[model samples]
Target: MRKALALSLCAVLLGGCASNPADRDISGTWINQVAIDAAAKGGPLREALQAYGPNLEWDVNTKAAQARYTNGFENVEGKLLGEKPGAWAVDFYGSSATELKRDGKQLSQAASENEPEQVFDRAVIPVPEGAPIGASFERALYSAYMGGSWQVVSGNGEGNTVQFQADGQVTGLPGADRYALCLAGDCASMSGGNDSIWLQQGGQGNSWIFARKGKTLEIFQSVNTALADEMPSYTAGDRKWLLEKQ
Candidate 1:
C-alpha cells in the first residue's frame, strides 16, 4: 500500500508539472506609435520608431512585430490602422507611449488586433541645484584629459585653487607654468604650458574648469581633488561642490 501511495504522489506531481508550461502567459504585443508633435511636423516617423527598439517588445501572439519605416506605423504583427482609438502615441525623446483616444472612445479595432501591447517606460533626471548653465564647455574639458581624482589642493577666498592627486594628476592651471586663477566674484582661468583652460564659474562660486585637448574634455573635482577622475562625466556635472552658496 505504501508503494502504491508513493507512486500516486509522484504521478500527481508530474501532472502538475506538465500543466505549468501550458499555463504560462506569453500574451502581449509590441505597441508602437508616433509622437503627436513629430507626426504633425511631417518628419520621418521612422526616426521615432527606431528610438524604441530597446524598450519595446512584442509577445508571440502571432509572430514577431517589426517596426517599419515605410508605412509610418509600429507594424505590430503587420497590421496597419489609422489614428484610431487603441492606437499608441509615442514620444520619441521621452521613450514613452500613450493610448490613442478619439472623442471619448478608444479605437476598438486597433486595440483588439494589438491586444496586450507593451508600453515603453520613460525615465527623467531632474536638474539639481548648482548645475552648470549654457554649454557644458568647462565640464566637457575636464572629462576628456584630466586623469585620476581631482581634489581641491589649495584655494584662496577668491577661487584660484590647485587640485592634485597621488596619481600624478594636475588640473586647473593652464599652460606649462601657468596656474589656475580665480578672482573671487569674477572668472577663473587655467593655462597649461601653452594650452588655455576654459573655466565656468557657477553662480554659487563652485567652478568647473577644463582644458581643451582635441575632442576630449577631462574633468576635475572642484572641492575634492582626491576623488578619482574616473567618475562619470554626468555624475561630475551633477555633483554639488562645496563652494560659496549661490
Candidate 2:
C-alpha cells in the first residue's frame, strides 16, 4: 500500500507541472510615455492637422506610448519598455481584435488578470522594405532644395558646405537657423559665439556667428559665389515642404 501511494503521488505531481494558458486581460486604458524614435515617413501628422482630422495622441505620463494611423489604414497604438534608450517594444492593436504578444512569453490561465501583456510588435514604425533609416537635417535640406540627385561638394572649415549634381550643375548649400556644430578638437570655443559667414563663388568668404539657439537658415551660401540671391528663400509656411525619410 505504501508503494501504491508513492506512485499516485508522483502522478499528481506530474499533473501539477503541466503548463496552463494565459489569463491576463489587457482591455483597459494604459498610460505610458514615448520618445520619438523615428519621425513618420510622410507628412501625415501635418496633413491630419490641416485636414481637420483626429491627430495622433501620445501619452503625457509615459515616455513610450503613441497612437497614430498606420499607413492611412488602421489606427495603431504602440508601447515600449526598457531602461536603455534604444531598446523598446511596441504593441499593435486593432480596433476590435484582441491584443497579441510580439516577443514575450504568454501567461498561464491561472495568472492574475492585472498582469501586463507583452508587446506584440518590436519596431516603433513599420518601415518599408529597403528604406533608409536616418538622415541628417543638412542632408535633408540639400535634397529638398537641389532635388534628390544633389551631392555634397565639400565641408568648409566653418559650419558650411557646398553641393552639386552630376551634369556640371552647382546647387547652393542651404543655411540652417539652428546648427549643431560638431567642432574638431574643441567645440567649446565655437559655442556661445554669434557670428555669420558669407558665401561667395570664386571669392573670399566672410564670417558671422550664431546668436540664438533656434535661429533659422535664411539663404543658401556658397564659397565660390553668393548664392543667397540665386536660390529661393524658404519661409515659415514652407516648412510643410520639408523632405521626409522613408
Error of 1 at 79 (Å): 13
Q: If scored against the real structure, what TM-score would every candidate get?
A: 0.19, 0.19
Q: How would you encode candidate 2's per-residue C-alpha lDDT over 73-161 as one tens digit per residue? A: 23345543322221223344432322222122221111124333322212233333543222122123223323332223223322333
Cα displacement (angstroms), candidate 1, residue 156, comes to: 48
List candidate 1 stretches off by more than 4 Å: 17-19, 30-246
lDDT of 1 by residue, 1-246 (tens): 999999999999988777342232222322222222222232222233233321223222213222221112132233222223334332223433334322221121122332332232111222335532211211222222233333332332224344432122344433222223221112321211212222333322233443323222333444332346533221123322222211
In TM-score terms, candidate 1 sits at 0.19
Q: Which residues of candidate 2, in runs, are more than 4 Å off? A: 21-236, 239-246
Model 1, residue 231: what's the lDDT? Answer: 35
